[model samples]
Target chain A: MTVKQLTLPELTEACVRLGVPGVGLWREPVRAYGTEAAAKLVHDAGLAVTTLCRGGFLTAIDPAARADALDDNRAAIDEAVTLGTDTLVLVSGGLPPGSRDLHGARERIADALAVLAPYAGERGVRLAIEPLHPMYASDRCVVSTLDQALDLAERFPVEQVGVVVDTYHLWWDDRAPAAIVRAGDRIHSFQLADWTTPLPAGVLNGRGLIGDGVIDLRAWRERVDAAGYQGPIEVELFNDTLWVRDGVELLTDVAERYVRHAL
Target chain B: MTVKQLTLPELTEACVRLGVPGVGLWREPVRAYGTEAAAKLVHDAGLAVTTLCRGGFLTAIDPAARADALDDNRAAIDEAVTLGTDTLVLVSGGLPPGSRDLHGARERIADALAVLAPYAGERGVRLAIEPLHPMYASDRCVVSTLDQALDLAERFPVEQVGVVVDTYHLWWDDRAPAAIVRAGDRIHSFQLADWTTPLPAGVLNGRGLIGDGVIDLRAWRERVDAAGYQGPIEVELFNDTLWVRDGVELLTDVAERYVRHAL
Candidate 1:
């Protein structure tokens, strides 16, 4: 089954056809097609929404702007609720402009989460903190390791807060396997992607499509499985080159790679 | 003193004049003047050579080429020995090209060290494994944390194996203080620099000139001092902007910043 091109509808349908149990959808697509419409499309296609791509950027210079982010995250929780996506992944924002204090920015993220967690809980959406790669430590995400994420999680109840363990971010971590075991059932989602060469812009464009880069996907999967996480493993690639290609072709390649390597 | 501009000679003389303690000299400068001449120049100027800026790239596809790296490192150790420097800093090379196995590459680094350690020891040069920031994990250095460096060091005697604790690579680490303590006397050298906003290349060229960036230099110095390391703290800045300025001006600025913020 070679997929060539796919829109949201076709992508959803193809997941079912390919026997993929769930799909992790990003915010742009959800916003573009309208959350309700996308939800209906997924439901009609008999596909489960595994996780929402993100909902956090709580670091900002302006207090009002930070509050605005919180409000927007509340809206994201509502959208996740409407889509029946239980996990809302949060990529904590980095330090604001004219500020080099990462520790302070982290505190702000925790404070914002303290406010948003209750709102997310009210909507039955679990807040899953995704610790991005340390490369993103300055400008993108302050939380850069699973241990750091787990440390943050300790501050909240397991039912209200969990963590998204993406292999791309945590694979190089020396304590990764142990951290996963420590996370146990609190591992809200497992994201799969390989580390590619020449990280573009050192941030956004460098994610490798599964099985294409250096990550030992099988080892990561085995560790996660051993940690007792029975949740769906979502293959999330942020490759600009792949996105430029046909979506169906990309999806087909992703599915095939998953079968051969990830599964 | 408000340092604005001064020549390289003036910079070198100032180190002597002020009894600046230690300086990590780059290869180009030393090579241009020739190793013997450069050693005499520094000795005449009464300066202490702390550590050579680098010596590692052992991960190469060809075995002969990889062996060449050890040869180069041997030359560097000779240079360090001639200059009266005891510690030779090693930035463990990243994964080889067309390779995805980071663990394999790390093993290759350990192997390289095992081959070179005896020669370095004979020359009375201690190899200090400087774990670069995790951002350099792919193209530069695989050792990304103090703990990782410590793990590598445990394989050898403390006098033979040491770690360079650079603030830029380690400030974000939650276990930094503990790692510093664990490092104890094996902490070969201490390097200081700040992490500024708007990171250039998302990794390189973003280091702050001491007080200009967000790191708590004084606090870090206190931690290292408390750990019983009374060595000279070298200020290593990879800032292109700073390099474009007069060398003497940069040195004076560094001295003032060290006294004001780092001491």
Candidate 2:
């Protein structure tokens, strides 16, 4: 959500002006702006819809909740199709409320993927499992490492499921480079969000502007390139500090940061 | 630092009164109380000094800084010996100032351990590598997983170096259970702190007291038990909310929670 302050049309317009070829759209804003209209806007502007933000909070113990999640995921897959983005990022949900069974919770994610992966595959949309940082393992997503994401995704066909290599989430992991190699063509989407210290309260919106943090963004880009991931390198930041600024200005900054640090 | 409000003597007294056999000591407070005096107080009170809180921060890029870290670690080992504790927990430091090389930082920790481990071992103490949570990997410790800690500790003799499986830091890792098994006798210390949501600002003092959040403490205890760890199960919380309460009352609450959730 780097330029979350911009409207869909404004985002597409900025991308075109900034020469940012592809735009990754979050589901909420897309739905709010009319998905078909958003698809048309980006399409008409000659920009690729790189990915649909999310769809997987499937770690529910309640059967009804599980059904709801599956339905939501199916809807997300449909949205991806409409947006013409083959990649649907799945943030596998955290442990169900008051449940200490992380294993069971992960298994539930696998179960949901079993139902959704093929549905996604049939529609030419791949489920991209984005393993968030372990700090987010409680309420955000239990998938906390590249290896864990690979373990889950490897069970499905390469065409059906894959992983997102986000620098912010996986930079602390020493083995992530090796895991990236293993991910190979299964690296569906590569995202960039640098890690900044003293994470903001709620720990949700502290993502750094690329070069502002310690991550070797270029090094990660090289590794992902070596892994045969010929995908769009999307800058997906959730930063409060940047959000308050003008959206177009932030987008310009992001484009400059990406070229300077991530290129 | 669950019962940090309690003085050394007060902590020892509470342990005795509550039939708690052992207490872990942090370096600063013990140094403040006089290391020898603190040792005598705990020993005279019939309590075991389970461990010394820490001795790390070896990821300095400057040679003089690295040398200082080593000298400080040497003193920590000395303090652990004086306290009659065989374990000195190490919170291996994070990135050196502007450095983006996590591998280099981790190598620095290894370099520090090479010097300190044997020194501690000679004095009947083991350097326990406590992998802080990945959230702390930026400023606190680069060793963010038990597997990473084991990777470092295994380079030294088990008597000289080992890993600390702190629930708060490790419970999020899907592979931690298997890593615990792999650790076997290299597991030096076991600590408890639960995972709570909407982490507080700064993110350093939000660790939950046992049973207050999402960790399966009893299961972790059982896993470590199965892995042949016979050490004291230390309840270490760095919660700001709990620190304001009465020390004795907090100790009682911790003891109750430990028995209920961690036993």
Candidate 3:
């Protein structure tokens, strides 16, 4: 939700001026800029749209909401295709309100993927299922581990449904390292952010700059490399403190930490 | 950290007055009250010390700190025996500051447990390893799931080391229900607290009253009971908001929620 005011043209120009190679576009801003224009802006600057910010929440218990989620996700896939991004990140929704059926919610995510994976595969767009941190397992996303994501991913073709490895969401999990290795080529997108303490209220915008938190970025990077993942490593930080700073400065800060901690 | 003000006598008296069968005792307050005196207070009041909180931080990398942890844990075991509690809660500490070796930290816990188990076993105390939520995996505890806690507990005799089934920590995990059944007789202590979102600044004081949040405490209680755990189902809530209130009213509230939600 950072950079809410920055225009698409300004962001793309800043990327070019700052020598940043690529950018991840969210559905809201890309749609605001017109997906085709956003695609052209990044492409004209010779930058890659690393991954589109989302399309899941397909675990709704309401019949109407479930159908809407499917339609919305299909639309999100079309937008990803238009933006020239192969990765459409899916944050599967959490348990329905007042329901503690975690098993049922997880099953809904898997079933949603079974339907959407084929839709994405035909368009050459991959559905990258992102396992959010366990803290968000109730309200945000129920897919809370790489192991869980891979378990769901393995159910589909490797080219269609894949897992996303984000340090901020997964660094705390001891199983993450082995899961990264086991993921192999199923890792659709790799993102970097750090985990900091005293997580803010809502706990959404507390992601730290790479070296500022406790994540072993270098170790995770090495493990991913060992897995033969030759993909773009996106430095995606959703930080409250950094969001208030100049976007260009934040980008520079991320790039600097990328070299210092994650190389 | 809740209920920091009430003295041991006052706490035990409150328990007796409120018809509360038992209370969870922390090491700091118990030590402050003089373990023998505190034990006598609870024992005379016919109150069971459900669990003595905690005796860990055994993940130290330095030799001296590690040795100190072991010594402290040994003393903690002796205190639990004095307090008339068979269960000694152990919150395995997180990564050593500035160290990202999660695997190393976990192994250190196992090593510490291997040493502590036999010592505890001799004294008729069970080391109940509590897997905190993953949000606390950095600074508080490396063990973050029932499965992981069981993996560590299985290495020792069931009488020497067992797992604590706390709803606040394990509710979000989809595998938790099965892990409960898998734990079977090794479930030493079962605690209840609900998972609430917008987790406080440090994410420590966010545990909700039994039914105040999203956890299916009744279901968890059922699962633990099904696992053949006929032990004290401790209602442990660590809410900052509740701590400032009158202890009697809070105890009354907890007692009410325990029946409506946990029973």
Candidate 4:
């Protein structure tokens, strides 16, 4: 697989060649290859679809747009179902445009979840609310802690809604271990990545490849395992450096490091 | 105050002339004026010393440097006592150099506080641990929420330790009001400022002058007041724009807005 550009076919081949058991697929990449074609490529390669990267962007200044988000999330659930991925990650969106009302945004998230959970349950997909880092509070996700994600999980049936515990977003959280224990079976996904030193131009580029930066991934694995979640732990790195490398090289490094440092 | 080429004496005189009641004096300015001379000037003017801007930088890679931090904090406490400021604001430093052990650094902070608390109490000064925003978690302060500050405060005597609830750091917290209520008498100081759009330089230049940004100051004042804190809510703006303006003009505008929108 080449680093300069990655097609669904190349990504699937890379995953198989690098021996990564599973991969977290972003929506744009899936859309690029067409969902059916992407699903067939991964399935043909015998690669597990750990999760679909996102579903929720519920914050909207207009009620119509808010309703539209729920409809869109239902479509995402269908996509997850088609991909044979049970977990659909949701990033509860930030405050409405020009609005500083964080509380109101939270309420909107709750409302969106209430609408989306039923459809996800019917589709046999578990909706995982991923608590982003607090840095994203202004323009990304309002859910910024595992405790907050657990709180949201409590509002829905256990089989329908859960939480994605990402090390990159939560490694600094003092309450992470306790929150993981509290999540128990509701912890649907355990995602890993490292926090880089210098934040890139977009802040998103600052995510480090697993084992590249400082994160207690072994401890996290023990915690999640102890909490009764035996699901595939996805390594989702968004590093510009890694992204520019040959896909085979990147995947091989990640797989080796994941086994040595994370698994 | 004149924006250009001002000596410490000139800066101090400008603060007094601006009718700001008290300034949140930093160590650099204190060092520039000589701590004793600065104290004498405040004493001579009969101006109240509201709070010292900082004390804690307890995280260091070298054990000797960490000990040095404790010693320096002791000196800061003595300076606060000499200045007649009841509250010494502590900005808990971030992860020690070359270490990703956040939990270990937190333990060191607790240990330092335990050693410093009794000495601070003896000097008739309270240590106010200010929890900065989470964005500064890596390089600035580990304490990043009001709830975390309250958790730390629970370890010390109410008279010796408390929290500085700054709106700039906490406006995004969903549990801020409840945490404020929980802090109650442990709330040593209430600081005001506004959150502006386009955070400048992504750090120091981002703070907005009161009423110029999006914080609901009146609601915050009501909540803090309801929590039974009768202390004067101080206006602490760290804006580059405000720093460039005439100190008299800045203070007048702040005072008028504080009364009109906050009180």
Best-matching candidate per DockQ: 2
lDDT of 2 by residue, B104-160 (tens): 899988988888887888899999999989899888899998889999999999999
TM-score of chain A of 2: 0.99
Candidate 2's displacement at residue A156, Å, is 1.9
If both were scored by TM-score, which would come out higher, candidate 1 or candidate 4? Answer: 4
Q: Which 10 consecutive positions of candidate 2 chain A have the poorest summed lDDT?
A: A94-103
The residue ranges of model 3 lying beyond 4 angstroms of the native Cα positions read A1-6, B1-6
TM match of model 2 to true structure: 0.98
Per-residue lDDT over A1-263 for candidate 1, one digit per residue giving the tens place of the 0 to 100 score: 12223568888877887788778877777888899999999988888999987898988869799879998898889889989999999998877876767778888888888998888887888899999987677678889899888877767877778999998898777787899999998899998888866666445766788877777899899999999999899887776778778776678778889989888
Q: Tens-digit lDDT track for model 3 on A1-263?
A: 33444678878887788787888889988887788988988999999988998999988989999999999999999999998989999999988888788878989988888889999999999999999999998999989999999989999999999999999888877678899989999999998888888788889888888898888888888888999898899887777788788876777677777888988
Tell me the TM-score of each prediction against the true structure.
0.89, 0.98, 0.95, 0.91
Better-scoring candidate (lDDT), 2 or 3: 2
lDDT of 3 by residue, B38-73 (tens): 998888889998999999898999999999999999
Candidate 2: regions farther than 4 A off = none
lDDT of 2 at A260: 96
| Weakest ten-residue segment in model 4 chain A by summed lDDT | A1-10
Q: Kindly report which residue stretches of model 1 are placed more than 4 angstroms away from their true locations once superposed.
A: A1-7, A13-21, A59-66, A96-108, B1-11, B14-21, B59-66
Q: Itemize residue pairs with steric clashes in candidate 4.
A: B1-B247
Cα lDDT for residue B219, candidate 1:
85
Report how far off residue A258 is in candidate 4 (Å): 1.4
lDDT of 3 at B156: 95
